[model samples]
Target: MNELERSVLAKIDQEQLARLCRQLIQAPSENPGGNEESTVLLLQSLLQDLGSTVHLQYAAPGRPNLIAHLGGGNAGGGLLFLGHSDVVPAGSGWDADPFTARREGNRLIGRGATDMKGGLSAVIAAMASVNQHAPHIPLTLICTVDEEANALGIEHYISTAEAAQYLACIVAEPTDLITIIGCRAAANLQVQISGASAHAGRPSDGASAIEAAAELVALIGENKQKLAAAPHPVLGPATWNVGTLKAGHGTSIVPDEAWLGIDRRLLPGEDPQQVLDALLAAARNRIEAAENLDALKLQIRGSVQMFMPGFLTDPEAPLVRQVCTTLQDLGAAGKHGIWTASCEGGFIAEHHNVPTVVLGPGEINTQAHQPNESVSVSDLHTAACAYALIALRQYETSQN
Candidate 1:
């Protein structure tokens, strides 16, 4: 590495990165509680210490988004590093306290350690290093809220002037250092089936909503098989899962109401509205064709609870090429690929038409939302170097 490159990499303090990651993980920003105020404040303070301009924007009460900008002489617009402050709830089943960040060998363990606290901390460290060494590198750091849930923070950001002015964006999602240039869309479906209630002994007196729900589940499974046959080349296939199902309260009574929650993942070029409409139509058709006829007094309804469209950035896009080149320079895999999971990168790419890439430390499978979540410290250092290099490269390119 050249002297300047070595200097940038050297400035990435490993201890500071670990400390910051631990602090972030210790702060609870769980989505269900909608509590990100403390995390937001922590980030704000960190950015302020670096002499960056910080602003707070709220999508809801106690849920605030932080935007920090480091001015530079580059004329090619700004580069945005997008990350979320909010994390999924730390469910039961853990060997240690989920809120306490612990260092076990090379891994730092905590609730948000890998999901993105590590990535976020690395980016912040890189930003600080870049600002000190190369002040001309224009950078924007967007620490958002609600990414684990509805992505309200990102939704609120795209409408701002800062998002519109950015040339490209890098989403600091855990990718195990593999660069992600595209992602599949995601949506949640809620289906409710209602039927007359009756005692279990009177089998002929009332219809069972539980049975109707099973029928709908079977129908969805059949449709899922059909969808699996036609897979997207990059994203694979559209998939659905019955994440939740609820029925009657007691065993002695026939279920009068049932609820099913389905999580559907879609590929690029698929219309979410059309997909929902098709699902509803299919369910209605199946219910109408049932052999029981009108005597059952059954009703079915389905609605979409959430929808996030898929997006793909061209491999040749400036941002993608830059990241791939940086990864290669760092002796890492520079190949561009698609992320099966949904992230805010797609939303930014789709809404702002900005070239975006999801690149960061940690593996999605082993770390995100799982018990004893952690990220490799070595990976964090590598990501810090990559982020600094990318920012410097963008700055140099802008000068030309």
Candidate 2:
């Protein structure tokens, strides 16, 4: 490694990264609770102490997106490092406290340990090192809220003038150091079925909303087959899963209402709105068709609760290339890959037209949101080093 690179890497303290991770993990920025206030304050304090120009853009009441500039003093533009502070609710089955971070050898265990608090802390710690070593390297940290529930944090950001300022964006989403250049979009599509109710004893007296919902499910199942038939080589196929179903009150009383929640995954280049429109049309058609509906007096409604479109960055982009090379330089995988970006990488790439990548410590599928979630300190420090080098590389490229 060169002198500058060596010096920067030397400053990436694993202990400090772990400490920050613990602080953030303990903050409990759960989305459903709208409790990101404490987490936002904690990050704001850290950034201010690091000499960053800090500001908070409220995405919701008491929920804010923290913007911190390490070197570039203005919010106009820089290499944007994006992350979300909120984590999924810590559900049951933890051996100990989900909020209490504990170390087991090199792994730091807690909620949000892998899904992304480690990724966030790693990037912030890298910025701290760069602020000390190479203050002229322009960096913008857009730490957002509500990445876990709906992506309102990033949604709010893309609506701002500052969103278009970034030359590139690096999403601090865990990829276990694999360079992610593309992602599959995810969305929540719900179907609400309403029908007249009557006594169950006289079955013909009332239309069954549950039966209409079943027809909707069958329609999506046919769609699922077609989607699975066509697949993106890198990011995989457009897909669907029936995750939730809420219906009925009593077996004796005919059900008046029913709800079905379907999860849709779209490939890059697919418009989320177009997909929604198609599904809505299909559902409406099925209801309108007397043959399919069997003359059931039912109203089936479809709505998109959330939609985060996928993105595919050019592998040749300078920042993207730098990210891959930096991972290799840090003695990790330089492999290019794709993500289902549960976070906002896709939002930034699609809406703001920013070249974006998700590269960070820990495994997304294996560790994120699981009981006893954890990430290795070794991985955190390595990721920090890579973050630092990538910042230096961005600065050097801008100079050239």
Clash totals in order: 0, 0
Q: Candidate 2: where are CA atoms >4 Å away?
A: 74-76, 284-296
Worst ten in a row by lDDT for model 1 = 71-80
Kindly list the per-residue Cα lDDT of model 1 for residues 1-400, writing each as its tens digit: 5677788888998878888899999988888789989989999998899888888998888888998888574332567788999888999998989999999888999999988888999999998898888787788888888888777887787777443666678889999998898888998888888888888898557888887787788898998899899998777899989999999969989888999988899886777677778887787677778776332488887787777777787788888888998989988888788887888777777666777889999989878989989999989988988998988887677779
Pull out the clashing pairs in model 1. none
For candidate 2, write residues 1-400 as lDDT tens digits: 6788888888888898899999989988876788988988999998889888888999889999998887865544667788888888889889999899999999999999987889889988988888788777778888888888778888888788343656778888899889898888899888788887889898677877887787778888999989888898877788888899999989987778999888888886776667877886787687677453434578777788988877888778776778878888778879887776555787777766788888888999998888899999999999888888888787777778
Residue pairs in clash, model 2: none
C-alpha lDDT (0 to 100) for residue 134 of candidate 2: 76
RMSD for all candidates, in order, please: 2.0, 1.8
